[model samples]
Target: MDPSTLLITFLFFLAALLYASVGHGGASAYLAVMALLGVTPAEMRPTALILNILVAGVGTFKYIRAGRFSWSVFWPFALTSVPMAYLGGRIHLPVRYFELLLGVALLFAALRLLIKPGGEREGLHPFALGWALGIGAVLGFVSGLIGIGGGIFLSPILIFLGWAETRQVSGIAAAFIVVNSASGLFGLLQSHPPLPAAIPFWMVAVLAGGWIGAELGSRYLTAPWIRRALGVVLVVAALRVLVV
Candidate 1:
């Protein structure tokens, strides 16, 4: 492999470890790194989505086996999100516009984390289903458009909506990401675009890194702290995208 491709593969591995350690799927970071590497946005989105599926699927299965997932809470959001994510993948938009929007979305998520009000811990509020579906649709669309897995936005929203406790959110997020990614990938497949043959090495690296990192995060990290740290990282990533 060329030095440039090897470097990108190494970066993907590093990103996977960081995300696994933090309970993130690493879409924003992947997008940022791809942009910095001068990867076309068209290639970046689908490639990242594929990586998100591989990583998040492993994490989700682990969480499920450990009884960390709550199906009661996951399905409603998936109902709306899966379809919308597919729709988003089908539509074509300007790369610059999409990246700008992604940056704005990340910034908004970070800001929400900073100022969110603390309140009684309700397990999936009465109106939360509606909110979940609505939010899921919007997030799913954006995720598909950008080739993201939707975990960055979905995890925080789950925390904000009081659907699940902070400790349980990561596993839930993993499952959510897996589902949306599958939908998005299906949408992309239907479009008949040529797949990048060189992506397998990078995918393997990300998968390994994400699995190991998520395992550690789930075992040792505190939920609230993980959420906060993820927000900080998102802000930095957003800045990187916006500036470049």
Candidate 2:
């Protein structure tokens, strides 16, 4: 492989490690980096989504084994998201529009982190199901369009709604990402044009980096810090997408 390809792969793996360490799937960073490297948006989205599935799945399993999984809090959102994700995958939007929207969403998410109100709750609220489903569907659709795993939005919503603590939220977000990415990939498969082959070296690098990072994140990192860091990264990524 060429030096440029090698460099890109290395950057990708590094980004994966950073994101996984924070309990993110790294789609926003991946998209920004790919854009900088001149990858076509068409290819970048699906590729990032595939990577998200791999990383998030590993993290989700870790969270689950640690007894942090919350099915009741997760299922309603997942139910709404799966179909929307498929729909988003089937439709192709203008690249500039998609990027702009993603940028705006990230910015909003960043602002949310900055101004997050304090909250504490014992369990899921009965009325939050509708909100969860609606937000999940919107996030899922965007995830499919952008090839993310939807955890970026999911985690924030959980925090805002007081459904779970930060660590538990991370685990739930990982599981949610895995499920939505699987559904989105299934949808993408039905497209007229199929996805490109997984670059074996890149895949291996991402998987290795993600596993190591996620393990450390689950064991050592605090949820609030993870969320804050993820928000900051998203903001930077959004700016890169919009301006560069």
Candidate 3:
């Protein structure tokens, strides 16, 4: 393979490793990389969603198997999110608008990574189902619109509200990413655009990285430094998108 393709493959693996460790699907990071590579917005969205599915799928299985997941914490949000994500995927934006919005999204993800929140509170707060549903709907729509799985936003919300523990948040976020990404991809497929030919190689790289990261995360691995490093990369990519 060419050097550029090899570099992209390696970056994809690294993104998956860091994100899956935190129960994310790495869609934002993938988008940032593509943005740096000068990929069109139309290609970026579906490609990111496809990668999100593979990586987050691994995280979901690992976190659930490790008993970090809570059904009560997961289902209410997912119920509203699925349909909203599908709806959002069906609506296409102008290329300029999409790039602008995606740049903002990359910045947000970078911010989330840089500002590491404290661990779960001693006493978990009771979740408000109504609030969760509303937030989920909004996030889901944004996910489909921006090609993210929404875990980047959801994790912090849960932490700020003290609704779930850190591990629980990770597990729930992973599962949430999976469903939303899958729903978004399904919606995108209706337009019948061909995916990038290199998707299979990217998928294998992400899966390998995702598995190792999930294994470490589910057991006992804290990666604040890794997150911060990735955050810096996202900031650069976001700047690239906004400037060019």
TM-score of 3: 0.86
Number of backbone-clashing residue pairs for each candidate, in the order shown: 3, 0, 0
Provide the TM-score for each candidate, comma-separated. 0.88, 0.88, 0.86
lDDT of 1 by residue, 150-191 (tens): 877777777767777665677778888888888888898787
Among residues 3 or more apart in sequence or in different chains, the pairs in candidate 2 whose N, CA or C atoms overlap within 3 Å are none
Model 1: C-alpha RMSD to truth? 2.5
What's the lDDT for all of these models? 0.76, 0.76, 0.81
lDDT of 2 by residue, 1-244 (tens): 7775677788878877777766677777777777787677667767777888888887888777776678888898899998998888777777677778767877897888766666445255444777888988998897776677888777766766778777777788888888888888777767644343445676787888788878877887766677777678668767966886
List of clashing residue pairs for candidate 1:
20-213, 20-214, 21-213
Q: Any runs in candidate 3 off by more than 4 Å, and if so which?
A: 95-123, 222-244
Deviation in Å, model 2, residue 110 alpha carbon: 1.6
